[model samples]
Target: MSAYKNLVPRFLRYVKVNTRSDEFSDTIPSSPREVAFLKDLAKELTQIGLSEVNYNPENGYVTALLPSNTTAVVPTIGFIAHVDTADFNAEGVNPQIHENYDGTSVIKLDPAGKYVLDPAEFPNLKNYQGHTLITTDGTTLLGADDKAGVAEIITAMEYLINHPDILHGDIKVGFGPDEEIGTGADHFDVQAFNADFAYTVDGGPLGQLEFETFNAAGAHVVIAGKNVHTSAAKGVMINAIQLGIDFQNALPQDQTPETTSGREGFYHLMRFEGTVEQTTLDYIIRDFKRDGLETRKAIMQQVADDLNHQYQNRIQLTLKDQYYNMVDIIKEHMSVVEIAEAAMQALNITPDETPVRGGTDGSKLSFMGLPTPNLFAGGENMHGRYEYVSTDTMEKATDVILKISELNVQQH
Candidate 1:
């Protein structure tokens, strides 16, 4: 029997629900389906015998507590994962389960054989040999970026609840929405959570742990122009679409997501809409260092200013800081990281201390006075159609969570 017998079923059930968040929405959860999923999760937590189960619609966070089974006064630790998937086609997600994957064959994803999970493209698939691999059909994302995390956390908590011999301190579990939209931590109640430290079960690959993340910001640029008949147009009319393309060209072409990796910052143009009268461009700025992030933002403003000067001040720019690197906050609470590292070591899972290329809810929470780090939940190629999760890796992550709880009591 699989050690995590309940983990697979739980993940499959959660991913089937379309919980993709909307970036354009102003509401709390950003989508109605996310609220429904959060409510269902709250009930499930209660059914699993977790105490103090509550879901706040105002912020769309579901929180539950597992009372301490031991008298040791260890720090109250929290486990967190987001309920909503990324901005992808999440409807009709038919999960494909491949048992005892040989790790050498191309896994067909659709009846038409349009999408194949090939090892040649994704070399990481080779690591899951002899393990059960779960993926999605060609039409939609697998939702494994975080649904796997959600299942692993809940299964770990269930394991603790069933095994009375395993002693632990007060444990808290949180499920939130809109993480993919970068607003998951906007209204998080950190003070009420009352945990000295926490971990976001939202990292990729097995044994991956993260304490550093990108200093992130989003920029919106709008260009306005007067339109005239093309036959009579010369200096009398300005083409907004052409001006928008010029603005993009003004930025460093080499400093982009496609050309950068491993602490190298990039300006990613996420969306572009254009017409003869008006054009809008959306971009995200990321860097490991705060100074670098600020410089990048300044460079964008300078480009906008230069364009506006030439175009009679017709360009408008808005840049908003989303989250900062959690390293500065987590460094002060190194024991929180040490506990997770020790837990992984205890289970013989070599910890991979990697810096996150993207931000997590913990990145924002760490700044909110809760020293939270990220732990892997065993998914690969997140946020897309090629997403997959190894059942063995997820089982190890669950063991890490349980072991961390136990280690906290014993070490303290």
Candidate 2:
């Protein structure tokens, strides 16, 4: 477990590859640049002694299998991480490496934004006072989101290969592109992955094990109205801009992201732009319970119906289901969660089992019949320049991966 001495360098090199996923792209990986990065990763996996390492440049997915050292038969578990950085700027990612911190004000050079980790703004700084904190230089984001997770998982696998005496079972490694924009699992070959249960090592902070995520759907609302001269507008004109505002007001404010947390779902307004003649409002609806999720969709429809009744069917609502809660699939095989829980406990980290307010590749993987859960990558403030990860937590996350491999055999 102590072989993480050179892990940071490997991870930093990977992040510098510019594997950011783009939502605007039609390709599965979203970016062809990710394929070049996957090639290097495949080479590293082979260098570290992972078996069956395969690099598919066309779709940009890298997979490798770590053979079991001990004769103990355990459930073949998979570890997954994403390679792409978020759509945020990756130019000049001057990652600040604070070897040992005194919990003082860590500043970005020429800091201009209101996005710093000040004690006054973030009281959580007190927690990592004495440890190492790696942050972006207030310019580009440090790709600690899932890159940290990918590095930790691979680092842990290397440790297992280096130490044969530490009994463990077979482990599979999966690294995909385009997770940031939600297409990481779109082209994944789960049957080829060949793991009964898996975990996405892509959660925030440490000891965070999530098997439940939001049942998500994107709602697009459109309104049609007639434009007329202002003097004659009273009788001939219909205003879609006002109708759009009314539609937003119709939803409960308390059910939004700012007011909701945990299993409590919310309606996230992704975009709201309109005009007097035509308006468009895009929203993302999320909830854990299937019935509650359906109820929310019904409420949205009801609002649209009422508006249409008033405006002579002028408003149209269209929804597309993004993803579903993976709980139903993951719960059927509860031992996978227990396996991760016991593994983290074995490594002396108190596991915090929480529902993800957001979705992950794990959400899609579980529905794909892999029954994947998520593990922490020891990061906070993801997808922004304020992103950072603790060296201690990253190392522990690696240990958790190793211990999970060991615990799988103990269960056998």
TM-score of each: 0.99, 0.93
- Any idea how many clashes model 1 has? 0
Q: What is the model-wide C-alpha lDDT for candidate 2?
A: 0.85
The residue ranges of model 1 lying beyond 4 angstroms of the native Cα positions read: none
Residue 237 alpha-carbon offset, candidate 2, angstroms: 3.3
lDDT of 1 by residue, 272-320 (tens): 9989899999999999999999999999999999998999999999999
User: lDDT: which candidate is best?
Assistant: 1
